[model samples]
Target chain A: AQRVTQPEKLLSVFKGAPVELKCNYSYSGSPELFWYVQYSRQRLQLLLRHISRESIKGFTADLNKGETSFHLKKPFAQEEDSAMYYCALKGGTSGSRLTFGEGTQLTVNP
Target chain B: EPEVTQTPSHQVTQMGQEVILRCVPISNHLYFYWYRQILGQKVEFLVSFYNNEISEKSEIFDDQFSVERPDGSNFTLKIRSTKLEDSAMYFCASSVGQGGGYGYTFGSGTRLTVV
Candidate 1:
């Protein structure tokens, strides 16, 4: 079975401080990783995907195959960065379903 | 930006009652999905539909659940008999391609409350 793990349920950081949200996955085959964010009273939206290798809203996540991790990182956290972040994994081939993590609720204090 | 739209922002029903949630996917998208999040839990995939039929479904989607695209513009999820544990926020999403490589557009969600 495929599973995604986000160890931290809640994370708090100060504005301008560096923040990191860790994500790990267990899948036998090649997997595609993605980060999704849900702000309060808003729908979940895509923050970034490992395949694009692009940064969104100053956040970047590198998929570490050796460690089986995809941790999202940002050099400077802003108040608006606070939200619920989820890690998701999709099988590299033949599947459209996504396995999601429990999610981390981030709080950025100004 | 195009978006998936779900109706009945909130619904409260008694246990064992049936309920149907509605969704309208982006006009050009080819794949549609239904997901649910229980209070303080992770979002779980329920099913995926394409070409007017179900393409994939998770174990959580048991016999009590069913999906249909009655027309070109709408997709619907029916829960034959809702239990108290079935209360959750149901979200609808659509993607232009398979595996969500192009990113999925999600609707605001319908909050279902089974009493």
Candidate 2:
């Protein structure tokens, strides 16, 4: 079975410090990975995807095929960056669905 | 700049009653999905609809759950005989296609409370 794992349920960081949220996945075939974020009282929104290879709100994630990981990172954490982040894998076959990780809560303290 | 919209941000229901959570996906999007998250839990996929049919569904989406695009603009999830366990935040999402770099757009979600 395909699964996504977000190792940390909660992570705290001081402002200006670097931040890393680890995500790992288990799947037999090639995978499409994504990072989605939900802020307090806000709807869930897409942050970034492996295929896009783009950065959003100063956060970037690199897809590591060999390691089967797509970890989200930021060079400097900001107080407003506090949010819940979920790692998701697009079920590969046709008419597929998205399998999501437990999610990690990132809190950047001022 | 289109976004998915869901009605009735919160709902209170009696167990065993039917409930419908409605959503209007992005106008041009072809793929629609329903997901739910129990308080403090990870979001779970319930069903995916495309071409006016259910393309995929999760194990949790039992016979009690059904989905339909009753009109050109509205997609709905109907739960028959709602259970207390069904209380959760239900979200609606849509995407351009099954495969794309662009991710799905999610609605604000409806919080269902069953007593």
Candidate 3:
């Protein structure tokens, strides 16, 4: 079974400080990872994907095969960045269903 | 910037009653999916649909649950008998294809409350 684990349920940081949301997965095959963000009263939106290797809103995540991790990181946290972040894995032989982590609440204090 | 849309932002139903959650995926997308998140739990996959058939479904999607693409664009999830545990935020998503690099676009989700 494919599983995703997000260790932190809540993370707090002051504005301009670096932020890292840890994520680990257990999957036999190569898996695609993604980070989804949900702001207050907004729909869940895709923040970044491992395959794209692109940064959005200054956020980036590197897929580490050896460690089986795809940690989302940002150089500096902004007050507006406060939101709930969910790490998801999409890879299984049968269908392209996503397995999501419990999610981490990030609060960037000004 | 196309997006997935779901109807009935909030639905309050009595236990054992039937409920239908509707969604309209991106116009050009080919794959569709349904997911649910309990108040404080992780998002879980319920079912996936493609080519007018069920591609996959999780254990939580039992006989009481069914999905249908009645029209060319509308996707609906029907629960025969709603249970208290069925109350959650149901999200609908879609993607171009399984192999595409694009991530699934999720709708705002329908909050179902069973009393």
Candidate number of the best DockQ: 2
Share of the reference A-B contacts seen in candidate 3:
0.77
How much is the lDDT of residue A105 in candidate 2? Answer: 96
- Candidate 2, number of clashes: 0
Task: Show model 2 residue runs off by greater than 4 Å.
Answer: none
Q: Which stretches of candidate 1 lie over 4 Å from their true place?
A: none
* Candidate 3 lDDT by residue in tens digits, B13-101: 99999999999999999999999999999999999999999999999999999999998999999999999999999999999988645
Candidate 1, residue A59: CA error in Å? 0.5
User: Measured by TM-score, how close is model 3 to the native structure?
Assistant: 0.98
Q: What is the DockQ of candidate 3?
A: 0.79
Better of 2 and 3 by lDDT: 3
Clashing pairs in 3: none
lDDT of 1 at A35: 96
Output the chain A TM-score of model 3.
0.98
Looking at model 1 chain B, report the run of 10 residues with the lowest lDDT sum.
B96-105
Error of 3 at B107 (Å): 0.4
Q: What's model 3's lDDT at B67?
A: 98
